[model samples]
Target chain A: MGAEFVQFSLTPVLIGVLSAIACALPGNFLILRRQALIGDAISHVVLPGIVVAFLLTGMISAVPMLLGAAGAALVAVVLIEAVKRLGNIEPGAAMGAIFTSMFAAGVLILEQTDTSSVHLDVEHALMGNLESLVWLRAEGWHSLLDPSMLATLPGELSRIAAVCAFVVVATLMFWRWLKIATFDEGFAQALGIPSTALGLGLVVVAAIAAVAAFDAVGSIIVIAMFICPPAAARLMTNRLGHQVVWSAVFATLSAVLGYVLAGYGPFWFGFEGAVSAAGMIATVSGIILAGACVFGPHRSRVGVAQQEAR
Target chain B: MSRMAQPTIATDHGHSIDPARAPRDTALAIHGLTVSYGEKPAVFSVDAAFKAKGMSAIVGPNGAGKSTLLKAALGVIPRLSGEVYVFGETIRDARARVAYVPQSASVDWDFPTTVMDVVQMGLYRKVGLLGRLSGPVRAQARECLDRVGMADFANRQIGQLSGGQQQRVFLARALAQDADLYLLDEPFAGVDAATERAIIGVLKSLKDEGKAVVAVHHDLATVRDYFDHVFLINVRRIAEGPVETTFTTEHLQATYGGRLAATHLDELAVADGAR
Candidate 1:
C-alpha cells in the first residue's frame, strides 16, 4: 500500500514542480515591479473567462480554455489601468473593485448555467482534483511520438511538461529585457528598450502561467504559487538574477515535498483519503514565505548586526 | 514699489561695474512654449534665450513652473505648444547632449538599487537597448563617481545613503551622461555645506568646459556669488540677464520683496500674540 501511494505521488509531484517553475520565473519580475497582487487578482478574475470558454466550446480542452483565460486576464489588467487613468482612482482600490466584481460575476454565471455534465463546477475551480490528473492523457501525440510510448505516460503529465518547457524557454529568451525593465522603466525607455512591449509580454506570460496552474491547483493555490516562492527568495537576495534562480529552487523544493506530505497526511490525520494536493502545496509555499519573513537572512538578528557593522 | 527707484549699481570693495554688461548667446531658445497639468497651465507662452556656456539660475516662488520649465526643456513634460532648441539644434535632435537632474524628493529613496546602478543608467543613451555595460562605460561611471567623491561607496545601496550622498550620486549620474547641456532642479536643497560646495565646483568646471548649466536655485543670497546669470520668474520671466544687472532691488521687489515682507509681518504678529 505504501509503494502504491509512493507511485501515485509521481504525477502530482511533476505537476507541482512544473507549476512552481512556471510561476517563479514571472513571479520574480512581478514582485519587483510591485505588481505581485495582480497575480492574485488575475487568478480570481480568470474564472469567468474559463467558464465562458467551456460554455462556448462545450469541451474541457486545456489549450482553448487557457488562451481564453489569458485574454480575459489581459482585459482585466487593461480595465484596472483604464480605471486608474480615467477615473483617477487609487490602484489598489481599482484592482480590488474590478477583481471581486468579475469573480462574483463568474460564480453567478456558473450557478445559472444548466450544463452540470460539462464539469464546470465552482468547487473544481477553487480546489482541483489531483486524483483525476493521474488518468488524464494526450490524444494525438500517440501517432507522432510512438503510440506504445504514449501508453506509458499520462496525457495530462505530457501537457504539464509542455507548459513547463514553454515557460522555461519564454523566461530565458526575455530575461535580459525583463531585468532591464524591472529595475528602471525610465532608463529602459531611454535606451529604446520597448519597455511597454516587454511589460505587456510579462503580463501575458504571467497570465499563461496562471491559466496553466488554474485547473491543477485552483485559483487561490495558484496565487500562492505566483507570490510566496518569489517573496521567499526576495528575503534571501537583493539582486534580481539571484532572486530568480533562488525562487525557482524554493518553488521546486516546495512542490516535491508538498506532494509527498499530501500523499501521507490523510493516513496520519485519520481524515478523508482524498487529501488536497493543491492545499498542501500552497500551505508549504506559505510556510516557506512566512519562515523567510521571520528567520531569513535579511530579517535575522545576525543579518541585521552584520549589515550594521558593514 | 519705491525700491525700483534705487540705482542698479551696488558696489563692494570700491568696484563699480554696470550690471547689465554680459555676453549673450542663444543657448536655449524657446518659441511660444506652453505646458499644462490636466487643464491648468503650469507654464505659459514663453519665448526666451539663455546665455551660452555659463551658470544660469532659474528662481521663482513655489508652483511658479520653475521645475516645469526645466522639465519642458528636457522634453520630459508634454508641451501644449511651441518648440525648444538646445544650442543650434532642436531638443529632439540634441537629446544626447542634454542631461537633467530632478529634485531630490521627486523619487522614492527606498527603491532597491545601488548607487553605481543608478549612475550607470545615465549611460543608457550611448549603450543602446540590449547593450551590455562594457569596460569603457564602467570606467566612465567610476570616473563620474570619483569626481563626486562617491567612488568609495559605488556598490552601496542607494537607500542606505545620506540625503547629501544621494544628491551627490544624482550629480554623478548627470556627470556620467557627459552632456553638453545640464539642467538641475533644486540641487542644493537639503544638502550639506560640503555637498553644496562640491556641486558649485562641478558647475564651475562644467561652465569652464563651455557646457550650459541651468539650475533652479532657491537661495537668493548666493545668486550673485554662485550664478553668472539669473532669471527671476513668477509664472513669467520677470527679468533675465547677468547677476550684476538682473539681481537689482527692483527685480527683488518684483520677484519676492512684497511676499517676503508680508510673510515676515505675519510671523512677527504671531510671535507678539504668543508673548
Candidate 2:
C-alpha cells in the first residue's frame, strides 16, 4: 500500500518540481538583465504557437508544441527588436506592443480553429490540470522498474526533466559569458566575447523553459516562477550564485507546498474538489517574494536597524 | 590644408619629427575621424594620434566630443567616417591588448556582482571558453585588485562601494587585462582627491611601463602636471602636442569659445600659466 502510494503520487509532484526548477533557472538571468517582462511576454505569446501547432499536426505532442512555441517566441523577439530599432522606442514599449498582439492573435486562432478535438483546451493552457495526470498504471513502487509502467510513465515529467537538464547544462557551461555580458556588456564586447549571441541564447532558454512549463503548469505559473523566485532571491542575497541557489529552493518549495495545498486544502474548508494547482503555486511564490522583500536578510533590515540606532 | 598628412613633418613638436621615426611609433592613430548624431556632427574631422608610450589627456570643455572621439575611434559607437589604428594595426588585431574604462555613469552599479567577478571579466579572452579562474589566473586577479587598493573589497558586492572605490575597481579590472593601451573616460569625475591622486599614480605607472594611456580629462588646471601630451578638442583638434608647448591660452580660448572670459575658465588658463 505504501509503495503504491509512492508510485501513484510521485509523477505529479515530480512534474511540478521539474517545471518549477526549469522556470527558475532561466529566471535568474532574466531578473539580472532586467528583462523579466520578456519572460511574461514569451509565456503569453507561446499560447498561439501551441494552438497553431495543434491545428497543423492534429495532435498534442511535446516536439510540435515546443517548436511552435519556440517559433512564436522567435517571432516575438524579432518583432520586439524590429519595433525597438525601427521606431527607436524603449524595449519595454516594444515588448508590450508586440507580445500583446501575438497573445491576441493566439486567442483569435483558438476561436477560429476547431480545437475541441485536441486534448488541450484554453483552460488547460491557462492553469493546467495536474490532478488528472496522477493516474498510475502500476500498483507498486516496483512498477518504476517494470517495463510496462515505465513506458506508461507520465509524459509531462520526462518533458520537463529534459528541458530542466538543458537549462542546467547551458547555465553551467555558459555561466562565465552570461555573467560578464550581464554585468558589463561594453567590457565583454571589447574582450571579443559574443555578447549579442549570449543575449539571444538567454532569450531562447527562457522560451524553452516557458514552453516546458506550459504543459504541466501554465503561462501564469511560468511567468511567476520566471520573475518571482529570482526577484525574491535577489532581495535575499548580495551574491549572484547564492541568489540562483535561493531561487531554485524557493521555486521548488512553492511547487511542493502549493501542490499539497491545492490538492488537500479544500477538504479543510469544506469545499468540493480543490483549486488550480498552478494558480496556487504562483500564489505561494508571490507570497514568498513579498515576505522576502520585507524580511529577507539584505532587504529592509538596513532601514529598521537604522531606526533603532536613532 | 592642415589636414594634410605629411610623412616628415609629424606634429610631435614644433613641426619636426625625424623622418626615420616611422608611423609605427604611433600607438594610436585617428585619421579624418568624424562622428555625427543624425543631422548634426558631434566631432568633425578630428585628427589626433598618440605615441607608443606616455600619458595623453583628451582635454576639452563640455560637449566638445572628447568622449565621442574615443567612442568613434574605438568603434564603440558608429562613426560617420574614420579609421583608427592601434600599434599600426586595426582595432580588431589589437583588441586583446586594449582596455577601455567607460564613464562611471554608464555602468549600472546595482548589478549583482562582486568586485572579484568584475575583475575576472578582464581575462575573458585570455581564458576563452571553458577556462576556469584557477591557480595563477586567480592570483593575477588578486594582484590587479591590490594595485588599485581594492584587494580587501574583492569579495564585496560592487553596489556597496563608493563612487571612487567603484572607479578604482574598474581600473583594477582593466589592470587585470594587462593591456598595452588604456582608454579611460573621466576616471576622476566625482572621485575623492585621494582617489584622483591614486588614479593619476596608476596612469603614470602604466606610462612608465611603456603602455599608452589616454584619458578624457575635464580639469584643464592639471593638464601640464598630470599628462605629458594633450589634445585640446572642440569638435576638432584645436591643438595637440607636448602640454608645456601646445596647451596655451589661445587653445583654451579656442576650446571654450565664448565661455572663456565670462566664467572661471580663465582660472584654468591662469593655473596652467602659474605651473
Candidate 3:
C-alpha cells in the first residue's frame, strides 16, 4: 500500500493541495468584498485566452497562458462594466450576462482554431485530469530524494507551486491594504488609498490563480475554493485574519480528505475502482460548507429567531 | 444673517454661490452643480456656500435631493457638471482635510469588522498604504470611540450592535478622521435619544473648534435648536442662511412643495429634551 501510494498518489495530492491553497488564499478577500462570483467568470473566461494564445504562438508555454488568462479576465471586467452602465442593472445581473457570453466566446474560439492535435479539449478544461500528473518514474520513496526525481517533476506541480508562492508573498506584503479595502471601500477612497487600482490588482491575481490551477484541478476546485472555503470560514469566525486562516484550513482539508475518499470510498459502495478525485475534492468542500452552516458557533437564521423569542 | 449676506455671483462654472465673505471663511462651495440620469436632472444648478464655524443642516422634503446635494459634493456619485470647493480648494485637492459620514442604511452592518477596525480606517491615510497601525494610532482610535461612548465595544463585531450603536460607531470613525470639515448624511436618523444627544454634542464641539459641519437633517422641530444655518433644498437651492431666518414657515412650505407631512410637537420636545 505504501509503495503504491508513493508511486501513484504523491504528485496528484500535492497538486490538489497547492492549487487549493493558491485559490483559497485570495478567496478570503473575494468573499469579503462580495465579488466571489468573479472567480467563476475568470475560470471559464480563460479558456478562449488560452486557446488564442496557443493558436498565435503554436507552442504551449506558461507565460502566454498566464497573459491570456489575465487578458480574458480584463475583457470580462470591461464587458461587465458595460452591461452595468448601459443596462442600468444590478452587479449580479451584469456578472451573469458577461460570464456566460465570455465563456461561450471561449468555446467558439477553441472550435474554430482546431487545436485537437494537442491533448486539449473542452471536457478536460472544465474538469481537469488529475490522475495523469505523475512522478512515479521513481523506483521508490528514496528516489524522490535524489536529484533525478526532483529535477524531472511534472511541470503542472511546479507551475502551481510557483503561483502559490507568488500568492503567499503578495498577500502578506499587501495584507493591511486588502483588509481595509475589502471592509470599507468608501473609507479607503476617502483616505486617498488607490482602492480602484488595488481592486484591479486583486482581480488580476485571482485571474493568475485561476489560470494556474485550471490545469491541475480544472475549474471545479478553482470556482469552489474561490467562494466555498472563504464563505464557510466566514460562518466560523468574526475576524478577518482568523477567517483567512480558517479558510486555508478548510481548503486543505477538502483536498486531503477528498483525495482519500476518491481513492478508497468506492470499495465501501461495492465498487472496485476509485472516482474523479478533483470532483470529489470539490464535493468535500461543499459538504464542509453545509456543515459550517449547521454547526458553526455563529448564529444562524433559526438561532436569531430563537433569541428574539426568548 | 445680513452681516454675511452677499449677492449670488455666477462664476464661469455657473455656480451661483454668495462669494461675498473673505474666501478663507467659506467651508464648502458648490458651483453650477447638475446631476442627471439619462435626460432627467436629479439636482439642477445647486449653488450654496457653507461657513467654517457653524452647524448647517441641509433641510428638504423626501426626494428633495437633500442627500443628493451632499453626495454630489463629495463626488460619491457622478456629477454631470459642476465644481465643489472645500476651503477655497477643489475637493480633490483638499480630500484628506474633509470627511464624509454616509447614511447608516447604506452600510452592511453584517460585515465582519470590529468597531476598532472601522475606526482605524479613518487614520489609514495618515498611516498611508503598507504602514502598520502603531500604538498611538490605536490609542487615538480608542479615544474617538470613547468620545462616542463606544470605547467598551472596541473589539465587538459591528453587526452585533444596535441600530443606534452602529450609528455611533460610524460617528466615532468620522471623529478619528480628525478632518477640518465634515459632511454627514442624516446622523440623527434611526438613532435613540442618547445617541442623538451624544452626536449633537460632538457636532457642537466641531463647530466650536471652527470646523465645518454640514449635515442632512429631517426633523423640522429641531431645526432652530440644532443648527446655526439651514439650506432649504428641493432639487435646487430654495434658501440658505442662519436657521433662525432661513427656516421660516414660508421657506419650509416652498421646499416641501406644499406637501407637508404631519409631525407632532412631542418629537420636537424630545429633540429639545435630549439636548
Candidate 4:
C-alpha cells in the first residue's frame, strides 16, 4: 500500500499542492482588489496562448508554452482596456467578451489544426492528466533520498515547485507594496509606489501562476485555487497578513484532501475507477469557501444596520 | 472686491506671476496649466501659486475642474500644458517634501486593512523595500494615528469605521508622511462635525509648524473661518488671494455662475457684507 501510494499518489499530490499555493498567493490580492475575475479571464485565454505556442514552436516545450501564455495574457489585458474605452462598456462585460471570444478562437484553432498527434486537446487542457504522471522508479520513501530515483520523478512536479517558490519570494518581497496598492492606490501613488505599474505587475504575476499551474493540474484547479482559498481566507480574518497565511493553509488542505479523495474514495465506495483529481481539487476548494461563508469569524459586514442608522 | 486691492502679487488673466516672488517660498506653482478630456477642456490655462506656512483653499462649484486642477498640478493626471513646481523645483526632485490626501471615497473602504497599516504606508519611502518596521517607525505611525484620535482603533479594520473615522484615518496617513506641502481634496466633505474639527485642528497645527496646506474646499461658509487664502476657479482661474479679498461675492458668482441661486447668492453676499 505504501509503495503504491508513493508510486501513484505522491507526485500528483505534491504538484497539486504547489499549484494551489502558487495560484492562491496572488489570488488574495486579486480578491481584495475586486479583480478576481482577472484570474478567470487569464485562465480562459491560456488555451489560445498554448495553442498558438504549439503552432509557432512546432513543439510542446514548457518554456515556449509559458511565454506564449504570458504574452497572450498581456494582450488580453490591453485588449480588455481598449474595448472598455472604445466600446464604452463596463469592465466585467469587457472581460467576459474578450475571454470568451479568445477561448472560442482557441477552440476553433484546435479543431482546424492537426493536434491529434500530440497530447494536446480541449479535454486534456481543461482536465489535466495528473494520474498518468506516476513515479515508476520509486521503491517507497527511500527513493526520495536516492538522487537517481529522485531525478526520475515527473518534470511537472519540479516545474510547479520552482514556480511556487518564485511566487512565494515575489509575494514576500513586494508584500508591503501590494498591500498598500490593493487597499488605496492613490495613497500608494502619492507615496511613490508606481501604483499603475504595480497593478499591471500583479496581473502579470497572476497570469504566470495560472499558466504554470494549468500546465500541471489543468484550468479547473487553476481557476478555483485562484479565487476560492483567498476568498475563504478573507472571511476568516480582518487583517491582510492573517488572511494570506490562512489562504495558503486552506489551499494546501484543499489540494491534499482532494487528491486523496479522488484517488482512493472511489475504491472505498466499491467503485472500479478513480475520479478526476483536478475537478475534485476545485470542488474541495469550493466546499471550503462555502464553509467559510457559513461559519468564518469575519464572514459578514460588522455593522450594516447601525451604520445606516448613524 | 477689486482684484487690484490685494497687497501681494495678483493677476487678472491667471498667468505671469511676479518673478520676484517666483522662487524659494512658493509651495506649489502652476503655469498655463490645462487639462482636457476628449474635446472639452476641464481646466484651462490655470496659473496659481500657493505659499508655505499658509492654509489655502481651492473653491469652485460642481464640474468646475477644481479636483482636476489639483490632480494635474500634482502630476497625478496628465496635463495638456503646464509647469508645476514644488518649492521652486520640479515635483520629481521634491517628491519627498510633498504629500497628498485624496477624497475619502477614492479608495475601497471595505479593503482588509487596519488603521495602523494604512498609516504605516506613509512611511514606506523611508522604510524602503524589504526593510523591517523598527520600533521607532511604528512609534511614529502611532503618534500620527493618535493625532487624528484613532490611536485606540489602530488594529481596527477600516470598514468598521464611520465615514468621519475613515477620513480621520486618511488624515493620519498623510500626517505620517510628515511632508512640507500637504494637498487635500474635499477633506471636509461628508465628514461629521467632530471629525471636521479634529481635522481642521490638525491642519492648523501643521500650518503653525511652517508647513503648507492646500485643499479643494466645498463649504464656502467655512472658507473664511478655516483658510487664510482662497483660489476661486470655474474651469479657469476666476480669482485667487487672501480670503478677506479674493473670496468675495463677485468671484463666487463668477465661479458658480447660474448654479448658485439668486436667493443663495444674496445670502452669501449678505454673509460677505456681515464679515
Candidate 5:
C-alpha cells in the first residue's frame, strides 16, 4: 500500500511542478495588471469550447481543445471590452457580467449535450485526476525516440511540454513591451509602443495558460495556481524580475508538497482515497496565499505598524 | 527682425532682460486652440506663438485652463478645434522632439517603482523593439539625475521620496528624454523653496540651450522674475506677451476681476457691519 502510494505520487508531483511553473510565469503579469480574476473566468468559460471541440472532433485532443478554448476566451475578452467602450460601463462591472454569463452558458451547454461517448463530467472539470494521467500515452514519439524512452514519456507529458514551451516563448518575446504596458499604459503610448496590442496579447497568453492548466488542475484549482503564487511573491518583492522567480519557486514547492499530501492523506484520515490531486494542490496554494496575506510585507499588520512607527 | 529691435524689460532680477536675442524661429504656433471638458470649455479659442527657445510661463487665476492648454498642446487632450504647430509642423510630426512632465499628483506615488526605473522609461522611445539600452542611455539617465540633484537617490523607491524629491525625479526623467520642447504642469505645486529653485535653474539652463519650455505656473510673483514670456488667461487668452507688458494690472483685472471684486466687497461690507 505504501509502495503503491509512492508510485501514484510521482506523476502528480511532476505535473504539479511543471504546471505550477508555467502558471507562475504569466501569473506575475496578471496580478500586476489587476486581471487576476480573469484567470478564473477564462478557466470556467472555456468549457463550452472544450465541449464543442470534443463534439466535432470525436476525440479529446489537447491541441484542438486548447485552440478552441482560446478562441472562446478571446471572444469573452472582446465582449468585456465592448461592454466597457459602447455601454460606458466600468471595467470591473463589465468583466464580472461577461465572465459569469459566459461561464453559465458553458455549464448550460454541457448539460444539453447528449453524447455519452465523451463525458464532460463537472467533478472532473472542477477537480482533475492526476493519478490516471500516469498511464496515458501520446503517439508519434516512438518514431523520434528509443522505445524505452518513448514508453517512459506519459501521455500528459506532451501536453505539459507544449504548454511550457508556449509560455516561455510568449513571455520572452514580449517582455519589454509587456513591462512598459504593465507599468504605465499612457506613458507607453507616448513612447510609440502599441499599448493596446500588448494588452490584448497578454490577455490571450493569460487565457491560453489558464485553459492549459484546466485539465491538469480543475478550473477552480487553476485560479489558485495562477493567482495565489504570484500574489504571495508580489507581497514579498517589488522588482518584476525577482517577483517572477520567487513566484515560480513558491508554486513548484507547493505543487510537490500538495501532491505528496494528496496521495497519503486518505490512509491517515481513513476516508475514500478519491480526493482530487488538483484540488489538494489548489488548497495548498490557497493556504500559502492566506499566510502571505497576514504576514506579507506589503499589507501585513505588523509591517504596517512598523512602518507607522518609523 | 533684428535682435536689437526687441524691447528688453528690467526687473528686480538683474538677468531679467530679454537678452535681446532674436527669436530663432517659430517652434510652436497655437491658432484658435479650444479645449473643452464635456460641454464646458476649459480653454476658449486663443492664438499664440512660442519662440524656438525660451522659458514661457502660463499663469492666471484658478480654473484658467493653464494645465488644460498644456495637455491640448501635448495632444493628450482632444481639442475642440484649431491646431498646434511645432517647428512649423503639426504635433504628430513633432512628438519625437517633445517631452512632457505631468503633475506629480497625477500618479499614485505608492506605485512599486524606483527613481532610476522611472528615469529609464524615458529611453523607451530611443530603444525600439529588441533595442537594448546601450551604455550611453544609462549615462544620459545618470546625467539627468545629477542635473536635478537626484543622482544619489536613483535606486530608492519613488514612494520613499518627499514631494520635492518626487518632483525633481520627474524633471530628471523628462531631462533624460533630451527633447527640444517641454511642457511641464505645475512642477512647483507643492515643492520646497530649494527644490523650486533647482527646477527653475534647470528650466533657465534649458532656455540657455535654446529649448522652448511652457510651464503651467501658479505663483504670480515669480512670473515676472522667472519667465521671459507670460500668458495671462481665464477661460480664454486675456493677453500674452513679454511679462513686463502682459503682467499689467489691467490684464489681471480682466482675468481675475470678478473673484477679486467679490472678495474685496465682502471684506468692506463686513467692516461696515462690524462698525
Candidate 6:
C-alpha cells in the first residue's frame, strides 16, 4: 500500500495542494478588492494563451505555454478595461464579454489546429490528467529522499511547487502594502505607494498562479481554488490576517480530502472506476464555502458587537 | 480676484507670500491647477493657498470640482497643468508630512479590517515594508483611536460601525499619520451632529497646534462657523480669503451660479445678515 500510494497518489496530491495554495494566497486580496471574478476570467482566457503558444512553438512545453497564458491574461485585462471605458459598460459585463469571446476563439483555434498529434485536448484543458502524472519510478516512501529517484519526478510538480513558493514569499514581502492597498487605495497612493502598479502586479501574479495551476489541475479547479477558499475564509474571520490563514488551511483541506475521496470513495460505493480528482476538488471547495456561509462564526454582517452598539 | 484672501499673496509664480503681520507659513499651495474629464474642465486654472495654524474650507456647488481640485493637487487624479506644494516644497518631496482622508464612500467599508488595523495603516511608512507592527507603533495607533473616541472599538470590524463612527475611524487613521498638512474630502457627509462637532473640534485642535487642515466642505450653513478661511470655486476659482472677507454673497452667488435657488439665496442672505 505504501509503495503503490507513493507511486500513484503522492505527487498528484502534492501538486493539488501546492496549486491550491498558490491561487488562494492571492485570492484573499482579490476577494476583498471585489475582483474575485478576475481569477475566473484569467483561467478562461488561459486556453487561448496555451493554444497560441502551441501553435507558435509547434509544441506543448511548459515555459512557452505559461508565457502565452500570462500574455493572454494581460491582454484580457487591457481589453476588459478598454471595453469598460470606451463602451461605458460596467466591469462585470465587460469581463464577461471579453473572456467569453477569447475563450470561444481559443476553442475555435484548438479545433481547427492539428493538435491531435499532441497530448492536448479540450477535456484535458477543463479536467487535467492528474492521475496520469504519477511517480512511475518511485519504489516506496524512501523515494522522497533519494536524489536519483527524485530527479525523475514529474515536471508539473516542480513547476507548481516553485510557483507556490514564489507566491508565498511575495505575499510575505508585500503583506503590508497589499493590506493597505486592498483596504484603502487612495490612502495607499497618498503615502506614495504605487497603487496602480501594485494592482497590476497583483493581477500578473494571479495570472502566473492560474497558468501554473492550469498546467496541473485544469482551469475548473483553478477557478474554484481562487475564489472558494478565500471567500470561505472571509466568512471565518473579521480580521484579514486570520482570514488568510483560514484560506490556506481550507485550501489544503480541500486538496487533500477531495483527492482522497475521488480516489477511494468509489470502492465504498461498489463502483468500478474513480471519479475525476479535479472535479472532486472543485466540488469540495464549493462545499467548504457553502459550509462557511452557513456556519462560520463571522458569517453574518448583522448581529455583530459593533452593529449591536449602534 | 484682487480680494483673493489676506494670507494668499499672489507671487509671480502664484506661491504664497509670507507677510509679517500674518506670520503664517503656507502649508499647501496650488498654482494654475487645471483638471478635466475629457474636454470639460472640472477645475480650471485655479490658484489657492492654505496656511498652517488655520483650517480652510474648499466650498463649491455640486460638480464644481472641489474634490477634483484636492485630488488633482495631491496627484490622486491626473492634472492638465498644475503644481502643488506642501510646506513650501513639492508635494512629492513632502509626502511624509501629508495625510489624506478620502471621502468615506471611496473605500469598501465591508473590507475585513478592524478599526485598529485601519488606524495602523497610517503608520505604514514608519513600519516600513517587511517590518512587523511593533508594540510602540500599535500603542500610538490606539492613542489615535482614543482621540477619535473609538478606543473601545479597536477590535470592532469596521463595517459594523455606524456612518458617524466610521467617519471617526477614518479620522483616527489620519490622526495616526501625525501629518503636518491634513487633506480631507467631505469629512462631515452622512455624519451625525455630534460627530460633526467632534470632528471640527479635532480640526480646530490641530489648527491650534499649528497644523494645517483643508477640507472639501459641502454644508454651506457651517462654513463660517467651522472654517478659519475659505476658498470658493465653480470650475474656476471665485474668491478665497479669511471667511469674514471671502464668504461674501457676491462670491457665493458666483460660485453657485444659477444652481443656488432663490430660496437658498434668501437663506444665505438671512445667514449673512445674522452674521
* C-alpha lDDT of all candidate models, in order: 0.76, 0.84, 0.82, 0.88, 0.76, 0.89
lDDT of 4 by residue, A5-46 (tens): 899889998999999999999999998888889999999999
Fnat for the candidates in order: 0.08, 0.43, 0.42, 0.55, 0.17, 0.79
Residue pairs in candidate 2 whose N, alpha carbon or C atoms collide under 3 angstroms: none
Q: What interface RMSD does every candidate have? A: 4.0, 3.5, 2.8, 2.3, 3.5, 1.3
lDDT of 4 by residue, B1-275 (tens): 56355344333434544434346689998889999976899999999999877999999999889988888877777899978877866666677898889998989888878889989988887887789999999999999999999999998888888899989998998888889999999999899999999999999999999999999999977888899999999999999998877777777889898888867766554256646
Q: Which ten residues in a row have the lowest lDDT in candidate 5 chain B?
A: B266-275
Q: Write the per-residue lDDT of candidate 5 for residues B1-275, one digit (tens) a residue.
A: 78567676543435333332212276667878899876789999977787788989887778889888887876766789977777655666666787888888877565556788889887777876668888988999999999999999888766678889999998998898889988888999999999999999999999999899988988766776788888878989988887666666666667787766644434322132322
Candidate 2 lDDT, tens digit per residue, A1-310?
Answer: 4665556567777788888889898889887888989999999999999888888898888789889988999999999999998888999999999888998998888988787776676788788877666746767777778787788887888789999999999999998888888887777777777788899999999999898888778888999999989999988887778889999999999999898889789997999898888899999999999999888987753454355447
Chain B TM-score (each prediction, in order): 0.84, 0.88, 0.87, 0.89, 0.84, 0.88
lDDT of 5 by residue, A158-188 (tens): 6776887898888888877877667765556
Regions of candidate 4 where Cα sits further than 4 Å from its true position = A304-310, B1-22, B269-275
Clashes of 2: 0
Number of the top-ranking candidate, with DockQ as the measure? 6
Query: Which candidate number has the best lDDT?
Result: 6
lDDT of 3 by residue, A1-310 (tens): 4656767888888999889989998888987778888888888888888787788888777678768877888899888878899989888889888888878988888887767888667877777888788776766788678887787778899999999999988999888788777766666666656778898889888888898998678888899988888889988987888888899899999999998899889988999999888889999999999999888776373455356447
Q: Which of candidates 2 and 3 reaches a greater DockQ?
A: 2
Residue range with the least summed lDDT across 10 consecutive positions in model 5 chain A: A135-144
Error of 1 at B182 (Å): 2.2
Best to worst by TM-score, what's the order? 6, 4, 2, 3, 1, 5
State the lDDT at A86 in candidate 5.
Answer: 86
Q: For model 1, what TM-score does chain A reach?
A: 0.88
Two-way TM-score contest, 3 vs 4, winner: 4
Regions of candidate 3 where Cα sits further than 4 Å from its true position = A1-7, A55-61, A108-116, A137-149, A268-270, A299-310, B1-22, B261-275
Give the per-residue lDDT digits (tens) of candidate 6, residues B121-174: 999778777778889999999999999888999988888888999999999999
Order by lDDT, highest first? 6, 4, 2, 3, 1, 5
In the range A1-310, model 1's lDDT, one tens digit per residue, is 2434333555667777887788877888887788887888889888999888888888888877887788789889999999988999988888888889888988998999976987778888887666566523433323336666456555566766777788788888766567656765544443345778888788788888888888676886778888999889878765556778888988997887777678777787887675677778888899999999987765453444357559
